[model samples]
Target: MKTRSGKGNRVGLAVLGLVLLAVGGLAIARALGSFGDAAAREPVVDAGARSFAATTPWFWPVVAAVGIVIGLIGLAWLLALLRVDRPRRLRLESGTTGVTEVDAHPASEALAEQVSTYPEVRRAHAVLRGPSDDPHLDIGVSAEEPADLGALVTRLHDEAVPDLRTTLGLRRLPAMVRLNLTGGRRTRPVH
Candidate 1:
């Protein structure tokens, strides 16, 4: 994969270099021709004017050469950006048919199930915070009501902690349930 990408970039750079060189050469050629024509007329004209026309050819070639060099430098910079490696998370796959399974499913699933039992909880998402060495979880709980923030935290702690301990065998549950009050519930009309 790396080699293929590198080769592609090289090919692109080569094409760009060729194009720039061609343009530069064309520019220089045109300038030189113009200068030559002016110089040929200079002998019939004045000495000062002849010198000025002679210097014109040198100016255009220098400008064209600088443009080509700048284009090459820009191409190199773009290639460097393309070649940089991006960081990615490692995913685990099942062996038989190569299906991907999420890491620490049991714990997260159990937590979600338990949190959903509360009447006030509208929606909940359990996410593992860290890697294996020292792991934690951030359980984001969207609530139906704004009341009882303290009570909700205590209730979740009381219910989830013991259940996680028994079912998932998590000795130290570094699980934090953050309650986000979405809005108040709609009131039903009296019949």
Candidate 2:
């Protein structure tokens, strides 16, 4: 849960501390050795001088530590990007009583059960509209065949408004049963 900038700062500080420790340790060792006076110590002195002028063994450790810190910073940045880029997941369920698995029921079944009680609606379907409205029921009806479209629309509006209000206890229904007419074709399976 740490932010990328915070993670980077922590890693940078840790690496800097380690590099400082290594360099300080080497300098202290050289300074201590220089205090001794002896001809036999000449090579040691020369080596220490050369090491001070040139890169020490600690150089690679510092580089590796810095590399690790940079890698960690990059990794944290990538994770933050992925979190923002991922799509959200949605979960839907019916608010009706005794309907445990609304998703499992076909759209036709849901429409028939919930909206078809009115004489106007002949067929109904539950549909999920992604990035549009929330989950809703779409109904298909026939005015020419045994039902009237105006009456059906009115009946559906009346029943749906109150049914959804009382059942879901929502101030307003999020979706409505959209009615369509097709000449006697069997309603497509809701799933």
Candidate 3:
């Protein structure tokens, strides 16, 4: 199964990072006297504290409400992290004329096994995506040394893909195949 992109998560993380960086940099700069001398800053702190002391009683309630809203946002973010998307299932017909449902995981495993049997491939994995009735495949293969990649691609296009489509009763079996070299070179003993 394929997972949806987490663009929202990325944006949230980026904004949080920038806010932390700005606030931390400001605090460090103030502590390091980048703003001015320490003696000159004493009056500014005293004036700010005096202004805060003059606030009306309603100010505290507004601050508490803002804190609650921030807490709710945190709760929502946590929920999103925990959420899982269910995989779609493939429907098949049994010899008894009954209908059967197969999960994507098992179907993908079968496909991976079929593809891995090729002499050039060291290992293979497949993932099914989209609805079960109309699915797409993402296949990854590890090739042995001296494997002919071009011939393999041709075989997939001509034989493997058509066989998969026919077996699955699908009109088209859209697939993405990735190949990687599996390093297995043995060192020889020197004289």
Which prediction has the highest TM-score against the true structure? 3
**Which of the predicted structures, 2 or 3, would earn the higher lDDT when compared with the native?**
3
Q: Which stretches of candidate 1 lie over 4 Å from their true place?
A: 1-103, 188-191
**Residue 130 Cα positional deviation in candidate 1, in Å, after optimal superposition:** 1.2
From the highest TM-score down, the ranking of the candidates is 3, 1, 2
Residue-by-residue lDDT tens digits, candidate 2, 1-191: 33666788679779989999998886666656755545434554577767765667777788789999989988986676555321132233446553333232343355457765555455455443332123333445444355576677677677754664344333444454555665554577786
Q: Which stretches of candidate 3 lie over 4 Å from their true place?
A: 1-8, 38-88, 91-100, 185-191
Candidate 1 on 1-191: residue-level lDDT in tens?
65787798789879989999998886676556755766544444478767776778786688789999999998887887665342122134336777453446566667887787777788777765555423566788888766677777887778766675445444565777677888776789999
Which of the two candidates, 1 or 2, achieves a greater TM-score against the reference? 1
Q: What is the lDDT of residue 110 in candidate 2?
A: 50
Which scores higher on TM-score, 2 or 3?
3
Quickly count the clashes in candidate 1.
Answer: 0
Q: Measured by TM-score, how close is model 1 to the native structure?
A: 0.43
Worst 10 residues of 3 by lDDT: 1-10
Q: Model 3: per-residue lDDT, tens digit, 19-138?
A: 999999887777778888774365545766667756767767888999999999999988878764435677654467777767778777887898889988889998876666667788
Name model 2 segments beyond 4 Å from true. Answer: 1-112, 128-146, 184-191
